[model samples]
Target: MIEEIQEQVAYYNARSQEYDEWFYRIGRYDRGLELNQCWFNEVDVLKSALQDIGEVNSILELACGTGIWTQELLKIGKEITALDASSEMIAINRKKLNDTKIVSYHQVDLFSWQPSKQYDLVFFSFWLSHVPPTQVDDFLAKVYRAVRPSGRVFIIDSCFEPSSTAKDHFFENENEIHQRRKLNNGQEYQIFKIYYQPNVLIDKLTQVGFQASVKQTNNYFIYAEGKKINKL
Candidate 1:
């Protein structure tokens, strides 16, 4: 599993340059203007949801790839600690933020990294699904430790939507945790990809000592917000 996680990091490092193309609906990820509109609409729903949580004094973002959510965090957070396994991704993120001083970037494998400090808010987007099933509890525990008392967590991820991928990609099986992903250059990598049902995830978070609520958009995304209610 560690080897698989390392490979996943390498894949993201290699994919960093073209990562925004998927988010911006360009090149291979352009499904159509209609689908693109739906994507952004769902993204807006997520943004609004995040805003509803009120302001955060400090935020810690895990797997802050390409700074998509990092940019959003800056609007509401006074300071942010962004962490990712790929230095290339952090480099692109730093470039996009124009070298913001308020945000500090750390390149470390999340599986082995421990938080030396806590924050009022913890955010991770499209990242939880990448966690292997065997490590979900440990990962959530790490997230729990990263949050200060009375702090909250917000997470966004995919919802098993077929249209969520590039036009050339296909979901080979419905019941698998490992998925094959391809880059525009015809490079391929196997990465952990697990789609969780909202209720199941809510229960899991609750079991891990979070007061959690998970909801889905009209399509394309599922988001959850939870407050730390007690120590795990």
Candidate 2:
């Protein structure tokens, strides 16, 4: 399991330079202008939902890739700590954010990294699906500890939409735990990718002592917002 997780980190590190291309709909990820418009539209939907959560004085973002959502969090959070396993990803993130004083970057493996302190919110984007099924409960427990009482947790992750990937890749069986991903250079890596249902995830979060609600974007993403109800 550790080896697999390390490979996942390596893949992200190697792909960091091209990561934003996927989000920007450029180069290999260009699906078409129409689909790209839909993508940003759904992204706006998620953004609006995050804004609706109201202001947070402090936020900790786990696996914050290249600061895409980190930039959004800055709008609502006075102070943000963004952590990822790959230093390369953090480098790009820092460059993108232009050394913002309001945000701190930490490069640490999420599986072994523990929070040094609690915050008003603990958030992660497109990261939960990368957690192996065996570690989901433990991971949420870590999130619970990182958030203050009455504080919130927000997560955004990919849905099983076939159009969400590059044109060259095909959607795999939903039940599969590992998926093969390729870089623009055609190098391949295996990573953990799980498609979680909103309701089922809500139940799991509830069992972990959260008052949670989850919603799906029209077709592309699943997002959840939960408030801590009790200590784990």
Please provide, for model 2 over 1-232, each residue's C-alpha lDDT reduced to its tens digit, 9 standing for 90 to 100: 9899989988999999999988888887888989889999999999999998888899999999999999999999999999998889999899989999999988888999887799999999889999999999999988988989899999899899888888888876887889889999899999999999988899888888789999998888899999999754
Please list all clashing residue pairs in model 2, or write none if there are none: none
Score every model by TM-score.
0.97, 0.97
Query: Model 1: per-residue lDDT, tens digit, 68-121?
Result: 999999989999999999889999999999999999999888888888998999
Q: What is every candidate's alpha-carbon RMSD to the true fold?
A: 1.1, 1.2
Any idea what lDDT model 1 has?
A: 0.90
Candidate 2 total steric clashes: 0
User: Candidate 2 — what's its lDDT?
Assistant: 0.91
Give the poorly placed runs of model 2, Cα more than 4 Å off: none
